[model samples]
Target: MSSKGSHSGWTRRRLLGRSVLAGAAVAAPSIVKGAQPTFAQTLSISALGKAKIDWQQFKGEDITVAVIPAGYFNNLIDVAGAFEDLSGVKVRFEKIPPGQIRQKILLDLSSKTGTYATHAADPMYYPLYVTNKWVEPLDAYLNDPKISDPGWFDYDDILEGWRSACSIEGKPYGIPFDGEATVQVYRKDVYEKAGIKPAQTLEQFVANAAKVHDPANRLWGAALRGFRGAGQNMYIYPSIFRAFGGEWFDPNKKLVVTTEPAVKALEWYVNLLRNYAPPGVENWNWPDIADAFGQGTVAVYIDAHSSAGVINDPQKSKVIGKIGYARWPRGPAGKRVTSIWNWSFPVNAALSERKKKATWLFIQWA
Candidate 1:
């Protein structure tokens, strides 16, 4: 979509095309179609220009980025107008819900339909992408003089754990945007009134929840992600599973979901939410749980650290300063296995060679 962010013939891109830094400031970007802002006024054209590559080479191309609707991903969409102005590439953001995005991304890539040039990716999917050759090796783009300036991109600035986790043989298949771990968030005021401290162990965790569970007051004990998706409940469950001493695979490399530890962990987790959480929690996702906590209807929550943004925002949260944060509690095995994950953006191998250039530009700029 063409940005309505333009006035007369002036744009951040037009200014950039003439002088890298001069006349940098203009009107705040108008909201473009979807969530994109109007111009790349905040982007440093001078630094990118130093690479001596043609930023406008793909000026008329269009690419779509399939993103799970979240703050970090929204931050990228917010500035897409600037990218569109700068590259003359029309960018569309499909802000799919978290539950449905994984399936769509997988199908788009595996089917090689090129429906999306890039997508919000999960770090765990890199190995499969590499093995199946479904994604372009990003090192080629990162090192290409025609499309990249490694020094300008600051390749080493990113954490090795995150960067390497998205690479195969030093060739990155994805660009990691956000790294997060699960944390326990509860209402401190409610806990104080109930005469209980935050949980340090699974036993204490449930006990604390039970102690504060006051559904009669419209306050349930806890709200957790219960929606059915690998990236939904499955994303939050591994921490619980590891805490319960459950391993995903046996030493011989067979799947291990039926093990005693696995069953015990799943049963405990399911029962906890079903019994103590608000009604219909089986259909809830992270945002839903966060909303419950923000609206003062839930006393505690367990989900991604990023969800804390929603729970702490004064604009949307009533609990505000009333919330307390802590590490995930210990399980019966005495292990505190917090969930660790990252979201990445990868170029779809399905995209045409020429379209991949525009996709790389978007990823690098983002």
Candidate 2:
């Protein structure tokens, strides 16, 4: 395939990196520095898109980046050799766990250590990062013709929702590395045998789940994240809360989890797990749910779009062509809500100007 057609797959893989290592949430740092790269020929198109930018602009600079040890960073490491050769910039990566990356970045910034010139920023914790002014605003680097080639980078091509999610107060703190949303993936064969179409409303979703549930025959109605903790609950609850017209906080920012809508949302969520989910689902996270769906042990699974890629891979999935994808069903409020997750690369404000600029070059390259 041509580079343009294949680029989306690469970007999708990068987006899925953080969630790849399930149940391995420990804090340790591993560094990957690119060796001198050699290329066979001059390529016309960049790995990013159809447009070509002058990547050699920042020759002979060194940059250090801290990232969660997800698939995205692994892919980045694979390509770093080429970037080093093209730009003459030695790129070093510090791999940290997804759960501890934020704390590590904060400490490095506050201590003026500049240990990491750039770090990955998760949208969930971006508000706090912005509040503390820990990341450098990327507007200047993005707009500079010398730094970013609009024709090549095509910043506007990024989905508006994804772009906006990475921005705070209308200013972009970082460039979007990956974007994803919650989606429902189901077994087409199972639905066909049961004579039911994909659910279009919340009520139908629940009913269909119950209808196809056959635990006695080793089939499950649904596979969902049921693990307790902010990381696990955050994925499933936000969409339910939004679907039910429940807000996390009032206009004054007071707690509102006990509101009528909130209660209904939580009740529905818990009941779905209690009644339809497989045994021991209470401890299941994304990886567990993904394994169930891929193994064809579940009829329906709802989580990030990242899992769909794995489920559709013929070699990795038992139900390859039998999968169907759909949006979340509409709630009683007539709204079908879903939450977004994005990873962005933001330069550390604590870095020297030269280091920041060099780091920006690497960010643009990635």
lDDT at 306, model 2: 75
lDDT of 2 by residue, 1-366 (tens): 113334643453343233333312332348768633323112312443333455666677788888866554665665566667667778888887655776787788777788888888767666776788877888888788767766556566677887887788888887787677889889999999999988888778889899999999889998678886544767777888888888888899998898888889888888988999999998887767877888989999778887775676555679888999999988877898977877788888888887788888777667
Best by TM-score: 1
Q: lDDT winner among the candidates? A: 1
Q: What are the models' TM-scores?
A: 0.85, 0.81
Clashes of each: 3, 2
Candidate 1, residues 1-366: lDDT per residue as tens digits? Answer: 012332312233244334322221222232224233334444444434444468899888988888776666555555566667667888887777777778888898889999989888877678888899999988788778999865456556566887887888888899877778789998999999999998999878888889899998899998788887677888888889999999999899999898888999999898899889899999998889998899999998878898886887666788888989998999999999887778888999988888998999888776
Quote model 2's TM-score.
0.81
